[model samples]
Target: MRIESVHATPGVSGFYFDDQRAIKRGASQDGFAYEGDPVTEGFDAIRQAGEALLVEVELADGTVVRGDCAAVQYSGAGGRDPLFKAEEYAPVVEGPVADAVTGREAEEFLANAELLEELTVDGDRLHTAIRYGVSQALLAAAARARRTTMTDVVADELGTEPAAEPVPVFGQTGDDRYVNAEKMFVKGVPVLPHGLINAEEKIGSDGEALLEYVEWLVYRSRELGPEGYEPRLHVDVYGMIGELFGAPYDRDEVVDYFAALEDAAGDLPLQIEGPMDVGDREDQIDAMCDLRAGLADAGVDVDVVADEWCNTFEDVRAFVDAGAADVVQVKTPDLGSVHRSAQAVRYCEGTDTRAYLGGTCNETELSARACAHVALATDAAQVLAKPGMGFDEGFMIVENEMRRTVARRERDRSRAAEEVTAGD
Candidate 1:
């Protein structure tokens, strides 16, 4: 189907930084999570507003589609601001970005998506969010052309079908995470707790300290969590693992350390993400490879997840080729297009490595549900609940979206079967 017009509108979500790095770094005191403007102000609770751009596309065939692109909240080592990203890029989406897609076929717009990167409206490169918003809308429009759900469109493009069940949802754990962990575990949801290297205490400086923290995390989880729910104890180190050796990332120490943490985790499944922030794309890949090799050599069961610098289709493929990570965290916004994100999922599937459909708490309900559709279609290992970062809301939106997707796909399948029988 051909695109008729693309419209851009403002959207926002109430959210908090997954990690308030700037505020944490500036804090003169140790311990406690910091948030809010005048971030010098500290609060035990974290909640903020995240801005987004909603893209709606109308097709000549009379079908309408909508998608969302959310800003990054809690940036890592060096991350961009949500306001700056939204403000700087909105004009491009409504102007040149939309202009590029208008009057073109949906598939045609996607095939030439790269040209948008080169054809900047001003000096600024097309923002990632704009690319994501436009591509998502196109995907939805293509689904309309096929008279199927958005998940089906992604599945067709990936040469696959939606999964038999909803993708597993992984919940994020903040300062008040244990409280949520108990609730999530009771409900059988997996949790990725970041209290490991909180602003209150820096980990990785001491092997023993890291072990103790892991032990503490596990002990509390088991203590508070439901007995039958063997939820995954996924932890995100965010490069703190690199500091354990005081720099120059010692491969052997890292391996031994993860082995120890796995031991502490016992039967609970443990996956460590961004253990070491080595820097840049090349260095990150190399460092991850070294870590992965060391873990293999040590026969450690800990799965290493790559997030830093694994922001695009090419980056994910390179990491997969080099065997840099055991789990590839493909955040939707970073890849821009849902098509590219799906491609990353298929690439990881080709290898033994797993693909985790990840997005920040800075996303929106629209973005989360859209990504859930992609995850359902691509067979992603697990999909993260985001935009709100809270355990309950993110999980509910993503899980509900997948449930509806599966139901729609089943209905579509049954109709096709009945049509075939009628012809017979």
Candidate 2:
């Protein structure tokens, strides 16, 4: 269907609630930390606040599809900066850019990456934010038109199905101490301790605590027995490993860390995400491959997952081609459009490479729905639907849409089967 009109609703009300803590870091007001650090760093703070983009797309059929683009604040500090910043740019986008997209065929608008590029202001995060919001709205509209769930749309777009088993997911927890891998068996997912692996907070940098943590994780998994567990420990290096352990550390130190991690993990698998802030593309790939190789040498079969480094289609292609990573962490905003993101996933199809739907800490229902569509479309092995978990809104919208999509798909499949039976 053709996009009749694309506009932003007026009254950019704040979604902020008092209970939410800002992701920004500062000392007490009037203190040295506050003096040196501004309360907001524009887009940088926005990335942390987990902002939502509210968008409306009107189709020729008079269907007005409205949705939000949930932007994740990777920095993990919670605040309203991202939302506030997105609001600031709403006017410009709703005014001109929306006008530009109106009356265009939805498929055409989505296909024209070049035309969409003209609507953006280079390097402006708001531009990125607005573009993301619009893309999400259009995607929702398309899904509505097809009378299908976003996931089904995505599945049709990309040929795949849910893994025979749910793929395990891991994230960094608060303590540098990695959670015992056995916890994943109980939770039905992988647990990568987050707080423990912060680049700046190297409390356990010597590898002693990390090793112990891994051992506990592995031992617990073994205790649970094979049927109870999926053998894999997930880690988020978050670019710090590259910065902190760069050439200065002897290869032995690196080898030691992987060796210990492997020994602790036992027969289970290990997947490392990050080392994000590598110096260059080639360097990033090299580091990932090197780490993967190191772990393998230690008898730890591991898969390296990429985040920041795998930001675009080109990035995905590069990582896959170089054999630098085994899995691609797909984030909606990182690829800008659901279609483009789906294409990126398609690119990885049939290869040894796999894709996982990564979570944006701050996601709204609309954005989450769009992401689900992408996940379904791309047949991502796993997805994170933690809507409003990190932010105030929680998962209401995302959960609702996810349910709707699944139900719709089931009905469609059942109807097709019935049609075949009736014909016979």
RMSD of each: 4.1, 5.7
Cα misplacement distance, residue 161 of candidate 2 (Å): 6.3
lDDT of each: 0.72, 0.56
Flag clash pairs in model 1.
31-200, 204-244
Candidate 2 vs. true structure, TM-score: 0.76
Candidate 2 structure quality by residue, lDDT tens digits, 1-424: 8777766643322222111122212123232112233343343322233445577777888888876654444421221123335556667667777767777666543453335645545544344445566777766765676776656555654555633222333432433243423333444444443332543444255555555666676666656635665545666655545544555223445666566666677776766666444545677777777766766677656566777556666778888887777887776565666666777777777887877666564455566667766665565655553453222132334435555666666778799999999999
Q: Write the per-residue lDDT of candidate 1 for residues 1-424, one digit (tens) a residue.
A: 7888887777775464443454444343335433343331332334344567778888897777888767555533233323324555567678897788788776543463555545566676666677676677777776677677778777766688679899888887654555766667567776556443543255534756656766766676666666666777777776777766647488887887888889988888889988877658899889989888888887898888998788878888988999999899897777767778888898887697899998777777878888998898898999997656467888899999899888877887899999999999
The estimated TM-scores of all candidates read 0.86, 0.76
Error of 1 at 91 (Å): 1.8
Task: Give me the overall lDDT of model 2.
Answer: 0.56
Candidate 2's C-alpha runs over 4 A off are 9-48, 60-62, 75-84, 106-126, 157-187, 190-196, 200-203, 216-227, 243-250, 388-404
| Best-fitting candidate, scored by TM-score | 1
